[model samples]
Each structure stands twice: as structure tokens, then as C-alpha cells.
Target: MKITGDHQLIKKINKYLVLDTIRRQFPISRADISARTGLNKATVSALVNELIESSFASETGLGESSGGRKPVMLLFNERAGFAIGVDLGVNYMLAMITDLSGAVVKKKRIDIAELEAGALTDKLKKTIRGLMPHVPASPYGVIGIGIGVPGLVDDQGSVLSAPNLGWTDVPLQSILAEEFGVDVVIDNEANAGALGEKEFGAGRDVSNLLYISVGMGIGAGIILNDTLYRGFSGFSGEVGHMALAQDGPLCGCGNRGCWETFASEKALLVNARAAYDDAADADAAAPNLDTLLSLARQGDPEARRLFADTGRWLGTGIANLVNVFNPELIVIGNRMSLASAWIGEAVYETLDSRSLAFHRSRASVAYSQLGHSSAALGAASMAIQRFFSTMKATWE
Candidate 1:
């Protein structure tokens, strides 16, 4: 007896396959796609025609042919739609707009003051409203919104808790989706950063990588075999709370000796202020990351030492992660990436000395290639992924 396949599912999958193929290898002919994906020429032709009709793919002219008439070449219509991605930090928010292909078209960053849940929601609404008009006239016009928050988020797109933001159980996803009338995605900033790196930055070349976002706090985004590992309950990457010393500085999470208290940007500032206070230095006009970075650039010994110490601690935590995960690459991202010149050597030295030689031998470390844009871009990519998965290309 013969069996029948689900025609709609098969068509969706085939269309998606053809779209993805064009996106990756555009200026390609349908024959090439048939060869690459092993779909029949007629099926590929039908799917490509449908994609062209949907404005997702376009003919770019004829291609060079060996004998017969030149075949028409195609290009993925990246500008056919746009997406919004937001990286919400404790003190700042960076919003960006990217085409379907993940190329940033516009971005804006605003400093955030202390605000409660209600006020924060209002602020986010305003920000989203502000970005909507600049989305560039496209077919899908802001297909969706993706946000990376520096906290825990449930699978439902709600921000479970953002301690630094003083937010807990905020139904941010629903709020945004309702307000904007578009799909919304919410995830931990570290996870977003990791995804961002994996998709478009340094980790693109490696299958297993760890993206560590070090800002006011430190959190990790684990990628195992090219996939983001969110862990049980969608609340992993809280490496900040990893205890380092039996007795160390108290963290806001009600724990002492947490990794962030010793290695994060907050840690650097805290130590900087203390050092300046101890020395009675007149330059203690409130040292933030910028000030410390300037001091280091000016060859301040104390600043150098402070950065070195932070790097050493960062290395210690990373060494522990390396031994456990054995990832091919560890990307240090977020606010701390700005201090790469000052802290890189120290981090490498410490990681080398602390990690097991066998594990250390295969793993390499690098700073974020996307710089501050990692989370935002990654968030946009998440939105894009959801869009594709739900857009008739998936069962949903």
C-alpha cells in the first residue's frame, strides 16, 4: 500500500526551503536550487514563482549559461520587510531597525532613568512609536518587534524578572504586541547576544560558543551545537550568580561572592570609586566605565591594575565555563567589550593559567565583533525567525 503526505505541510516546507536557498545563494538559478535541495525542477520553479509573486524573491537578470539560453537569476528581497529589535539595558535602551536580511538600516539609543514598571512600559511604548515611522516603506512594514532584556523571561515572552530594572512579572510581550499590533519577542539580553553572534558575528564560524554579556551584570548565553541552550524553565545564563569567593562583595541578588560583583562593569566602577576614595584623588567625580577607560588610556597605573583585576576574575569564571562546556569559542560582549584593550591580556593570561590545559587548548576567546549591537541585532533575528516560522512556512 502507498501512503499520502500532507500536501499543505509539504508545500510550506518546500516553499520555505526554496526561500532560504535564495536568501543564502541568490543570483542562483532554479536549476541550482534543484541541485542543492534535491527538489524537482518543476517544484522549484513553482515555489520560486510564488516567492516572486509574494515579493520575497526577485529576478535580477540572466545568468551565464553553458549552451542553452541564459537562465534568469534571482535575489532575495531583503527590503520587502523590516523588523525592530531592542536591547534594553539597566541604564540605556538601544533600538534598531533591520531589513529581513539582518542589515541594520536605522538605530537610536536613549539613556533611561530609574522608573517603575508602569513608567517603564510607557517609555517602551513611546520608544516603539518613535521607531515605527522610520521603518521604510516595505510590504510587511515592521513585521515584528524583538526585545532583549537584562533579566529572566518566560517562554510566553513575558519578562519574569529584571532585577536591575525593578521589574517583575511584567507581561511585556502582551503589552507590546497589543500596543503595536504586531508580533513581539522577549528574551534575556545574554541569550540574544549569543544568538546574534551565532547568526551574524564571531560565532558564525563555530558550532559551539558561549557569548558572555558583561554590563552592569554578567550573564552568559550558551550555544551548544549551533543552538541556543536556554536550559530548564527558559531561565539559564544566570552565570552572574555563580559564587567565586566564600567571602566577597555582596551582590544585589542577595548573594556574596557572586561573579558579577567581582568582574562586571559595576564591579569596575565600585572598585574605582573605592580606590579613588582611598587615595583621596580629586578626580573622583563619579567614575563610570567611560572615566575608567579614559584613565586606562592615559596610562593610569591604578586604573590599569583595576581593569587587570577585573579581567582576571572574568577569566576565572570563563575558565570554569570552558571546563564544563568545552565550547569552540567564548565571545566576551556588551559594555565590558569596550575595555578589551585594557583587559584582554589579563583575561587571556588568567584563563590560560586556570583552565585545564586540555580544555584550554581547543577553546579560544574573542571580544564581540558586533560591539554594542549584538543583542539588538540578535533580537531582530529572533523576530525574523518567528516571522518565517509562522508565515505559512510553518504549521502555525
Candidate 2:
């Protein structure tokens, strides 16, 4: 009986290692796990069997042979648990459900005009309840939830003045954890966007990069030496509020001439409205930015000019970022990249004029490949990474 119990404990330890290996590098074979982890083939096979029995992993058919019998592949059982990623935007909330491999199985967009703490919490609870029907059930249960709120979230997940959301001192993490009965992580949206780009998008391979998310407001996610650089008080990447133009437009953050006031989607929309209101066309009084984008796409000279000006402002910001950090890449995200052709030229123009040649030569700017979905995608990746990290920590 003592020997049997010891064997069971050893089996459990090895099984967890197998499951973790599969979670980190899925679509792998037992032999590959053995080779990478330096575990004997017999032990790997036995641990894989336990994981399969516990529904933590599923066997794939086969891999290419190398002068031996074909190896059976394995992947994490994505259906074993569900994770939710919420992008709490100034104008809307985007909630997405993704599996273990970061594939979005379902998504919902909720319109939010006012961001009263109580009302927003109620809405979030309802949104999660509404999404419960879509979640897949398995052994480990829904591991955790991640939220990307557009503000300075402290380490404990308290909101510190999300000006656009009208939030202050909101215990967002605790509230969500109580409601969901799971772990919750809340972070700045731009930081989340940076994490997303590094893990699954543009900065996957680059050691140093900046992901600039120009949404309703401008924000940046900085990755230096391949890690998210959240400085003191988790507010390092709040570069949007940096002073750019003296005595320019006042920002909602109670600042004058903030970079976001000149470079954000809100800025573009505000400028478009001003331009439209003064246009010769009488039908230009509509309050839709998408319409403005469409008009610009159709060769409206005024709209094109507005986008170019916005792009230049964005490029100026990028030049400053490059001058400071000297990253290898800069990813322009949100709807800002919608006008990439125009913005690309403006970005190059500013870089050519202002940035030092050495810094300019090192950085290559590009539009976010994932486009507007970068934040929510990053939130999903956050959930997965947190889960694996927690598992590894526990094992250690």
C-alpha cells in the first residue's frame, strides 16, 4: 500500500508536468515532450495517459515519421475550460470568449455611454451571465477572467481615474472576482495591447517594440527587453497625456495640449465634425466617424487632409517614442491604422524631419496586424499566460 501511494504521487506530478508542457507547446508529440523536458519516453507516455484520462489533453492523430513508427501528437483540451477577455472601452465594451489556444469562439459588443461604477459593474455581471451559455465546460473549470480597462489600474486592480470611463477608485477586480467566482486581472488597455502584440501579434519575435493604441484616446504599451514595462504605480505607459502642443485643445484628462487631444480617434472624429460642419456639402452634418472614413476612402479631399494631419500628429508622437526608447518596431493600432497609406507617409515624413538618423534607422513602424482587436486578443492571451504561470508556480 505504501509503494502504491508513492507511485500514485509520482504519477500525479509527472501528469501535471505533461499537461503543462502541452499547454505551453501544444500540437506536440509525447516523444517531443520527452526530448524537450529530458523525461524518459516511458514516463512521458505514462504521464500523457494520466492527462488524457483527466481530460486535460487530447491526442492528435500522427506526426511525420523519422525512420521509426509515427509519433502521436497531443494538444491541450481547449474545451476543458473557458476564459473571458473584456476590453472595456470608453464608448463600448468588447467581451470575447476564447479557448486555450487563444481562438475566439464568441464575442459581444456592449454600448456604454456613461461609466458610473455601480452601473458598469452591473452591466459587466449581466454580460458575463449572458455569455455563460456559450462557455464550454471541462475539468479545470473556467480558470480566470481578464479585463483591459483604459486607465491606470493599480496592482490590486483598483481603477485610478479612467477619465473617459468616469471611473475613480473602483475596486473593479474584487467586484468582478466576487461576481464570477474566479480570479480576475485588470490592467491598462494599452498595456494589454502591448502584451497582446508581443504574445500573439506583431511583436512576437522582436525584443523591443511599442504598441501605440490610438483608440477613443491615445495610449501606448511599451515592451523593453521582451517584457511589459509597467513602471511605478503601473502607470508608465500613459504616454497619451504627454504635453505636445502648447496652448492646444484641452483634453478630457484635465490637461491642456495632451498628445491624445491631437492624435486619437476622438481627435480625428472631432476634426472631421468640424470639417464636415464647414463643408460645402449640406449633407455633411452627420455625426458618424465611419461615414467620414468612408468619405475619405472615396477621395474626399478634406477628409483625406484631416487623416493626414492626424497621422502627422501620431508620427510626431512616434518620433518622440523612438527618440526615447529606440524600439525595434512600432505598431500603430486602433482605427488610426485605417488610414495607413496616408498615415504611413506622414509617419515617414515626421521621422525623416525630427528623429535622429541612428534612432530612425533602428525602428520600423507598421500597422497592427490584428487591427482593432489587439486589446481583447491581448486580454485572452493574458488569461492563458496567467493560468500557465500559476500552474507552474504551484508545481514549483
Strongest candidate by TM-score: 1
Return the lDDT, model 2, position 212: 93
- Residue-pair clashes, model 2: 0
Q: Name model 2 segments beyond 4 Å from true.
A: 1-21, 38-50, 393-396
Q: Candidate 2 on 252-363: residue-level lDDT in tens?
A: 8898999999988888888877877777773754635577678777887887788889888988888898999999999988667777876678778987788889999988
How well does candidate 2 match the true structure in TM-score terms?
Answer: 0.89
Quality of model 2 by C-alpha lDDT: 0.83
In model 1, how large is the Cα lDDT of residue 375? 98
Clashes by residue pair, model 2: none
Q: Relative to the unseen true structure, what is the C-alpha lDDT of residue 289 in candidate 1, on a scale of 0 to 100?
A: 88
